[model samples]
Target: LVVRLPLYIHLIHSHIHTFSFSYILGPMLSYFNFALVSASINIFFFIAFLFQPESPYYYLMRNDVDNASKALSWLLKADEDETDKELELMRKSVEEDRQKKAGWKDLVATPTDRKALLIRFLIGFVRQFCGIIPISCYSTQTLKAAGDSFIISPDNCTIIMGIMMVI
Candidate 1:
């Protein structure tokens, strides 16, 4: 929910600025304003990220259980007993992950791995045939082509598409 909400809001803001500037301020100025808005959002996101607590996983990976406990406790609002149990579980999971240590060779080593690889490749190949990328790339133009069919303006249609993608 946290991730989705921010993405939705960002897309909505982007669509609004895109339509407003291109319609009212002209195409050339809109490009400049788009750059300005992008930079501003990036700066804001960076500043906001700085205030977030370091992930408990980071400390756990470094074998700093004390700091991991502290961070996890703060994040989860859990009691010390609960924190200890969670920390132990995380430690075991991390150790197991490190022990597995699979290399690129393992990708084709077994039937299961081969099947997984084939499935992944097939999915990627199929995805390229989907018109989503082209449609997204030329969304404004695509909407403008159907300008008469939509009750709202093409600009609003594009904005709604952006919102829907985020959702």
Candidate 2:
């Protein structure tokens, strides 16, 4: 797990970076360039996943507690007793989670849940159909229409947007 931490962080960073770039710089980039960048990121993620270590939680689920304990000790630099206790707590949490069977239909069955669900869905739908993409894609043309000459480079804009997201 320790060895795979960097890969996990990379995966998370790539996802947030991609979304930020899409949302903030999509219009500035040519569609072809955007596709190329997206493909490159995907390939990087594939390679990272290829070398990532398997989770100890998965091993425990398969009744391989000895191997799971060893993995935990390696990641935590802790004794076997401490690792066993930690793993036991995790097993309990998984059991509790499994006992709670909440589904989408249940959300809609309750009035309060249904209202919350609808509002969340509406927000997501509105965001997807917003004109931000078109505005960004034709940013130069839009500026020209306004008789302006200023241009916003996508890379700089994306970095700024990524910082905002992190904050």
Candidate 3:
């Protein structure tokens, strides 16, 4: 929600400027205003993230059982019995992930690794057919083609899409 809200704000600012709605305030300088606002918001998000909870698994990895249990308790909604069980399960999953992590040689030698490689390959291949490349490269043209459906200008929409990708 935080990520998308910035894109919406950029779009709204674009609309206001395009329509000369902010002409009474000052000149319509887009990039400078957006950059200042985005930087300010990023600072706020960084502070907010500092106050957020650390993952229980992180504490477990550091061999801090007390902190890990506390984190697990919070994560499991303070359900005491479930916290221990879930923490143990998380430990097992983490160990398995560490063990399963493979190198280039293991990628083709192991069946599981080969399956993972093929899945990644297929995802990459399929994305090319999803029209993302052309829509991104020729975004103005794409927006123009879809123009009639929207009340907002295609240029503003394209600008918003760019911001969304950046965020």
Tell me each candidate's RMSD, in Å, in order: 6.8, 5.2, 10.0
Worst 10 residues of 3 by lDDT: 19-28
Name model 1 segments beyond 4 Å from true.
1-29, 115-135, 139-152, 156-167
lDDT of 3: 0.68
* Model 1 per-residue lDDT tens digits across residues 25-140: 33234567867866887799899989877667778889888888888888778788988888788889789988998899988999998999999899788768877667755676
Best-matching candidate per lDDT: 1
lDDT for every model?
A: 0.72, 0.69, 0.68
Q: lDDT tens string, model 3, 42-108?
A: 7999999898677777877776878988877865685777888878887886678777867779668
Q: How many residue pairs clash in each candidate?
A: 0, 2, 0
TM-scores for all predictions: 0.59, 0.62, 0.49
lDDT-superior candidate, 1 or 2: 1
Candidate 2: which stretches are off by over 4 Å? 1-16, 19-34, 144-146, 149-167
Q: List the candidate numbers ranked by lDDT, top first.
A: 1, 2, 3
Model 3 alpha-carbon miss at residue 59, Å: 1.8
